[model samples]
Target: MAERKAFHVAVVGATGAVGQQMLKTLEDRNFPISKLTVLSSARSAGKAVLFNGQEHIVQEATPDSFEGVDIALFSAGGNVSKELAPEAVKRGAIVVDNTSAFRMDENTPLVVPEVNEGDLHLHNGIIANPNCSTIQMVVALQPIFEKYGLNKVIVSTYQAVSGSGTQAVEELYEQTKAIINEESYEPKILPVKSDKKHYQIAFNAIPQIDKFEANGYTFEEMKMINETKKIMHLPELKVAATCVRLPVATGHSESVYFEVEQDGATVADIKALLKDAPGVVLQDDPDNQIYPMPADCVGKNDVFVGRIRQDLDEVKGFHMWVVSDNLLKGAAWNSVQIAESLIKIGLVK
Candidate 1:
């Protein structure tokens, strides 16, 4: 493989939680960088953030801020991406958006690098990263989707509060203390920040993760079901999800039941496939009580899969647990990985 000259890169929402992780991932990966511009909301502009031990000032992100950027990574929010992504594209920047604003767009490629890196070549100036939970799930499932053929999927997520934001993590800590001290506290954020109701996320599991759609699934659940189909390019694939926010702070875990098209696929077959799968760590040791867990997967970029077993009732069905850092593999690392794919495939100059 040959290396190309470093390209100019800009990160939109440089000061937010996921954005900070994106910057760190780019640094840790030693991504080629001729120039780096850190852009943020007006509220966070002018703040100084240390990157690779050097100070970089966050500037307000605007259409004009993308003038010379060859690649723009977006994670601020959907509204922000919806507004500025086109401008970035107009200025010759390839946008890797980490929001729902463009994930379902017919023209945009919804990618999970492990599952759909080839989708990068089809980008019309923008590529969409799948939802956090969806990214880790498909990474674990794609190998199966490829070898045996996937027929159906049912996932129940145990997502961490960090997926909500830094504030939700703060509220969880604050609420925990209030409870331990026998104090009273009102919940202000969790499940969904903008929803009409808020719930305690310290010791409780909130079954609803995002706003409810007319179809009765919360937005988060719909994101999983729909995005899974799109990423796997199996729109007719049957999928369902129930997303829940847990007290844990970083990783997202899922109990997934999937049925394959191939008959008589054994549990050992599934384990063997995942053991060598890309972006997946296999940890299925029941006798030793080894399995993937949120606390253990907090800082890792790889999705962890475990507790593999054949479903008793459904011969074609298998169940497994999948876990990954919502901040890293779920958002930042996935976004950065898409950018790297762009460079690797020569989609970006």
Candidate 2:
């Protein structure tokens, strides 16, 4: 094992939404850094970003950019990560990729730190960060899965516009103002920008997040389904997701219905379990109107769980609402936490 030292850190796509969050998280978490490199596309190259109160110029990412870098955090895009992540790995950097590029790769570990930090030891240089929606769900589900064993999970997501990237957020803003002004405007860059058609996200809920798959599930929903199984090491576990994009700017919420192998599970039992679970905040009091909301969860790292109840007829079925700041727990913060785990577990040099 290599002796732990302050690392030469690189944040690929340092100018993007998640990239900005990653930089902020690195600072907030006090990650040990001997040097920091910020990389982006040619368009963003030469742009300056501050790290540790010092200005660093963003450079165009290339295979050689990983030289002397101990850990590379990638969130540019799938194509960029697909090309550069292997290069980063070849240069002796452990890549914590925050894209869909290598997520489904059998050799890649799709990890939620709280759920599968132990799996990080098996990395062959690249470790995947799970989808923003998937990360919070797994964190909340881990304790329950460990204690009672999960048989099924069906999640309906109320996702924020930011998940679509910076442009989508701006579009929502403009569209909302347009709707209020009763002005005619065109709809683009929504419900999959490259798809055949676009829909307005102003004061509306879009049921699809990513492009539709041949199996009828949107790519985003499939990511939640498939990534959950991979991270949990439960290929046989039944999982399904209906991902919806709401008009909110931050945080992702899910109404999750699940079945536990353990019978006679009560609402109180689940509450007690989550109350002590790592990275979970329990707020399930219906009478007082207590529950997790996306607006209230913004900037928070903990996954919030509330609205716990047993199914009306099915003894094994239980439901709960889970929420979290997607940018924090979902992307940047989780990626940084994985880096921290690498240090704590002595995986990074």
Best by TM-score: 1
Once fitted onto the true fold, the runs of candidate 1 whose alpha carbons sit more than 4 angstroms away are 1-3
Tens-digit per-residue lDDT, 9-127, candidate 2: 99999988899999999999888988899999898999999887889899999999999999999999999999999999999999999999999998988888889999999899999
RMSD of each: 1.1, 1.8
For all candidates, the clash counts are 0, 0
TM-score of 2: 0.97
Query: How close is every model to the real structure, measured as TM-score?
Result: 0.98, 0.97
The CA root-mean-square deviation of candidate 1, after full C-alpha superposition on the true structure, stands at 1.1
Q: Cα lDDT of model 1 overall?
A: 0.92
Checking candidate 2 for backbone clashes, the offending pairs are none
- lDDT of the structure predicted as candidate 2: 0.93
lDDT winner: 2
Candidate 1, pairs of clashing residues = none
